[model samples]
Target: MIRVVILGAGNIAQHLYTVFTKSEAIQVVQVYNRSQKALQSFTNVATTTRLKELRDADVYIIAVADDAIASVANKLPFTNRLVVHTSGSASMHVLHKKNRRGVFYPLQTFTKGKEVDFSQIPLCLEAREKTDFKVLQQLADAIGSPSYKISSEQRRALHVSAVFVNNFSNHLYRIAHEICEANNVPFQILHPLIQETAHKITTLTPYMAQTGPAKRGDQKTIDDHLEKLDKDIHKEIYTLLTQSIAKTYGREKL
Candidate 1:
């Protein structure tokens, strides 16, 4: 079995732990978190709050916040072992040089209490050594995840793109919900459109899938939207997005 130590109890950590446990080829030997309450769900495995008490394992996966990764890795009491992080943005170099460094970033947004199919999530792997990379790939394979060998630079670029698609897009959804609420309309009305738009990208490039008043350079429709928005911030956002879309479709003058 590929012994693994997960060093966090957050959303990604919990999800990973659950999936790893279901894989016979991978064993989550230990789960460490500074907060005892956070480690409560990981009752079946060995748990510790102290870095000095970490157990020997084939790999140590730091599933903590991006900012806290280096500090945690620097504090690890062991050295010359495979250490990896589950951060999409942070580089593998963030880990202390004391241990073999790698990145095991799963390019998907994880939420507590939400069960996601690990096999469908793309696993971005990076390691300083070839052997360490193989170990990460084996772990990914054990979990039935599609693994990709990516460099730190490529991973950084991918992370920025993720924010645009996932984070920024979610914020737009919230804005739409707010607009619907203000108009006394059900937010669920847009659910089908949202799903259709999401599925369209799977078969068509986003540029080709584009369709909207802005794409058609309908300034009157754009102005109506801006005027209908009650909040200045919402109007500003609408104008900015309209401009972006118009420029994308060669309707920049609109």
Candidate 2:
């Protein structure tokens, strides 16, 4: 069995602890945080606020904030054990050199109280040693996740792409919601389009799936959209995205 200790109590940490405990091949020996209050969510397992009190486990998984990862790793009482962090952007080398470092980045947005299917989430793994990489892979498999061996450089690129696809896209949805609210239209009207757009990318490349007035070089429709927008920020965003789409399809003159 792969014994593990999670080193945070945030959304990602809680999700990981829940899934790890469910897997027969893995065991969550303990969970550590800066305080005992957050640790309360982790029931029936060992919990501690002291780094020196950490138990011996096959791996120590740091699921803390990106900035705090190094600080937590530096405080670990022992060295040379497998230490991994669940961060997409932070480099594995950020963990103190006192221990073997690896990354176990789950490439998905996690939210508190929302249950996720671990089988569909991509687990990006990186390590200096092949053996260490294998250990991460085993952990990923135990949780029914597909694991990818990615370098720190490649993981950084993935992180940026994730921001574009997930964060930026969500912000666009928020903008659309605001627009709908301002115009007295039900935001639910856009739900089908949103679902269809997401579903299309499954079988079609985003470039091929692209369809809109901007893609068709319909300047009149694009102009109508900009004119209908009430907020200057909304208009500006519309204009910028229209220009971007036009440029992508080689219709920059539009």
Candidate 3:
């Protein structure tokens, strides 16, 4: 069995630990964090607050915040052992040269206290060495997820695109929620539409599925949407994005 060590006790770390421990080909030998209290959920698995106490695992995965990754990686006592981080925005080089560095970024937003389906998440793998790349790919397969090899440059692009799709999309949801509250309409009314919008993209590209008054250059409706916005910033953002979408589809008038 491939012995594994997991760093951090956050949402992503917890999810990965749970999944890795269940894999037959892998065994979570130890879990380390600066605070022992954060490692509470890892019952039956060895836990430590000291880096030196971390055992001789085949691979060490740093699943902490982007800022804390380098600090943890730097403390590893071994050289040439596989070390990987689960960050989408952080570069693979952040890991100390004392160990082989790689990235096992799962391209999905993770929220604490909620369960995530690994099967739906795409694992982006990158390593300077081919052997390390295969190791990451094997790990993704062991966990029953799809894995893609991406360069730091391509990964950066994907990370930025993810911010647009996930972060910006969530903000749009919040805006819709507020609009519903102001109009005394239930937000649940938009649930079906939201699901359908996401479902449509599975079969149709966002460019092909694009719709609305903005795409059609309906100046009347565009003006009405902007006038309905309670906040000036929201109106500005909406207008900018609408204009961008219009330009993308060759509808320059919007």
Candidate 4:
């Protein structure tokens, strides 16, 4: 069994602790954070605040913020034991050179206080050495996850694409919410449409599934939508995106 010492007590840490603890092929030997108070959420596992007190383990998984990773890695008591960080945007080189470095970043949006479905999330693995890569892959498989061997360059591309899918998509939902509020319509009415929009991409390419007043070249409808938006900034954004989408479909006027 691969023993893992997780370094962090945040959302990703909690999720990984839960999943890894339940896996038969791996064991969570310890969980460490800078503050002892934050470790209360973990039960039946050794928790510590001092990095010097970290126990021997097959791997030390740093699941902390981007800025704090190096600080934590620098404090590890031993060198050359596998050390990995679970960050999508941060590079693997950020970790201290004292150990076998790798990135075990999970590509997905994490919300505190909400349960995450790890089975649906993709794990991106990167290692400085081949042996470390196999170790990371073994852990991923133990937790019933699909993983991809990605270089720092490909991971950067994935991170940027994720921002467009998760961050930008959430902003669009906020805009939709505001529009619903202005029309005295409950935002719940859009829930089905929003769900369907995401579901459509599973079976159809986004380009082929695109549909709107703009796609149909309905200039009158496009103008009405812009006028209905209460905020000028939102109207501007809507107009720009609509125009861009229309142009892609050879209906530039809309």
If scored against the real structure, what TM-score would every candidate get? 0.98, 0.98, 0.96, 0.95
Tell me model 2's lDDT, rounded to 2 decimals: 0.94
lDDT tens digits by residue: candidate 3, 146-185: 9998877889999999999999999999999998999999
The 0-to-1 C-alpha lDDT of every candidate, in the order given, reads 0.94, 0.94, 0.90, 0.91
Point out where model 2 deviates above 4 Å.
none
Candidate 2 on 136-168: residue-level lDDT in tens? 999999999999999899999999999999999
To one decimal, what is the Cα RMSD in angstroms of model 3 from the true structure? 1.2
On residues 1-254, what C-alpha lDDT tens digit does candidate 1 reach at each position? 99999999999999999999999999889999999998888968999999899988999999999999999999999889999999988999999999999999999998889899998999999999999999999999999999999988999999999999999999999999988888899999999999999999999999999999999988888888788889999888888888899999898897
Model 2 Cα shift for residue 126 (angstroms) = 0.8
Give me the displacement of residue 130 in model 1, in angstroms.
0.9
What C-alpha lDDT, on a 0 to 100 scale, does residue 197 get in candidate 2?
98
| Model 2 weakest lDDT span, ten residues long | 222-231
- Identify the leading candidate in terms of lDDT: 2
Supply the TM-score for candidate 4: 0.95
List model 4 lDDT by residue over 1-254, tens digit each. 99999999999999999889889999999999988899999999999998888999988999999899998889888988899999888889999998999999999888878877777888999999999899999999999889999988889899999999999999999988877887799999888998999999999999999998988888888888777778988988898899899889998756
